[model samples]
Target: MPENDVIAAGARTVIRLPRPADQAEFLARVRDSAALHHPWLAPPATPADFRAYLERLTEPQTEGFLVCERESGALAGFVNINAIVRRAFLSGALGYAAFVPYAGRGHMSEGIGLVVRHAFTDLGLHRLEINVQPGNTASIALAKRAGFRLEGFSPDYLFIAGAWRDHERWALTAEMTADGPGAGR
Candidate 1:
């Protein structure tokens, strides 16, 4: 957890910045996970899209991390923090997707915990928020597991997949993480 160094390793997963070398493998995983993602997520399944995705994440206001299996160095999933506001209100929005053969294995839960810690301690972010579709129980569960509390709901909060979708807002403050959720457990 150093300046501009995006790596947070855990017992099973390693969360690090996405690289150009990961294009082929990441795209392959995205294609393989089509059904698993579908309406919930539409990651870059094509090489061109992947490049664009990477470019966007590399911007000053965003961060993209890949959760890789520690043993084999295979991609497990991805987490992106977008719209980071660093002045008075240090906050960002969280988005994540798990690839095939790795989904439901709890890698994301662990990676998210690491990311949350990094965002609070290293990045000096005061708050983080996750917006999940109500029908996506898995995403909601992941957020809750990472200590994000239910904040509220917004109807048609975002436009995705050709339609406006309602989303449940879940958030966690750095103070909350330091005091209760991820303090000493």
Candidate 2:
């Protein structure tokens, strides 16, 4: 994605690429949202950590996007597409977090829909997947609302919070929707 590229636009929010300058405000929000994110996520809360986060996303296999409220241009959350594979599978995994102030406000749902659309159309990928901890109901809800279907459950899908956690795999494909490229919109 290009710098500041507007990936998608919704009534309440816009999804765009994260910029280096967003470190200060993004870290501040992450710090303030520590409680809200505990046990569910652990986004970068310091300048150095945030920089490292950005660096990882700078790799060819990863992409980071920020969901910002259109009215104030304040970040509501972020979605990252990781492990992109292009040759045959044409798929990627998704990870995201909704900030404290924006949690439960439907920003993530809208943002995720946008990201799904971008993944299928702009990125030319066939499928996008999200792996959510079984206990994270909010994340699962967002994935379902955005049209991802529950595939299966894995015993030790990911190592999070210093332990191997079970995860529910959810996925969506461009071919699954009748509306084709405009389905997510």
Candidate 3:
């Protein structure tokens, strides 16, 4: 795949997987957002750790992308389609977050919409799930905007911010894409 052609939603941004050359830039972004993201994302741990994390996500079994500003090429955020399960069920979980500076700009919603289309139409995934803490209104809103239905809540589902938090489960199916819900603009 072309490094620049991974996905685009024509919303002043693009989504594509990170390359090794991006390590220094990506590390800087992670460091800058340490406080805002530590509650959910591991706090970088180390430069090597960040590289390893990115390398793992680039594997065939996982699909991950960085949200970049079209004009400036700034690293705004990231999204991941992980833990793919192919068997009786073809599914994966979606996780995403924008740097504090990029929040509230609607970039995440647009990036997610593009990735969802790729997951269903290009990757042929059947289902996508998102787990968000009860208090994360922004994430919950993004999920809804991307046409994921609130399936239910899972108590103590994940250890976030040093505590186990209840998560609201949201999901979208490939069928929903054909119907226009998960279709990108």
Write candidate 2's Cα lDDT for 1-185 as tens digits: 33356778999989988878899889888887888777876788778888899899889889889998877889999999999999899999999999879999999898988888788778888888999998898899898898899999999888876788899999998887543566657
- For candidate 1, write residues 1-185 as lDDT tens digits: 33254488899988999888899899899889999897987788788898899889878789889998887889999999889999999999999999989999999999998888888888888899999999999999999899899999999998877789999999999878764346776
Q: How many backbone clashes does candidate 2 have?
A: 0
Q: Which has the better TM-score: candidate 2, or candidate 3?
A: 2
For all predicted structures, in order, the TM-scores are 0.92, 0.92, 0.86
State which candidate has the highest lDDT.
1
Total clashing pairs in model 1: 0
Q: Provide C-alpha RMSD values for all models, in order.
A: 3.1, 2.8, 3.1
Query: Which pairs clash in model 2?
Result: none
lDDT of candidate 3 over 1-185, digit per residue (tens)? 34455566556888887777777877777777787665665634467887787878867778888888777777788889988887767799998878768877977887888888788777878899999987778788889899999999999998866788889999999878753445554
Clashes per model (N, Cα, C within 3 A) = 0, 0, 0
lDDT of each: 0.88, 0.87, 0.80
Give stretches of model 3 more than 4 Å off.
1-5, 43-45, 178-185
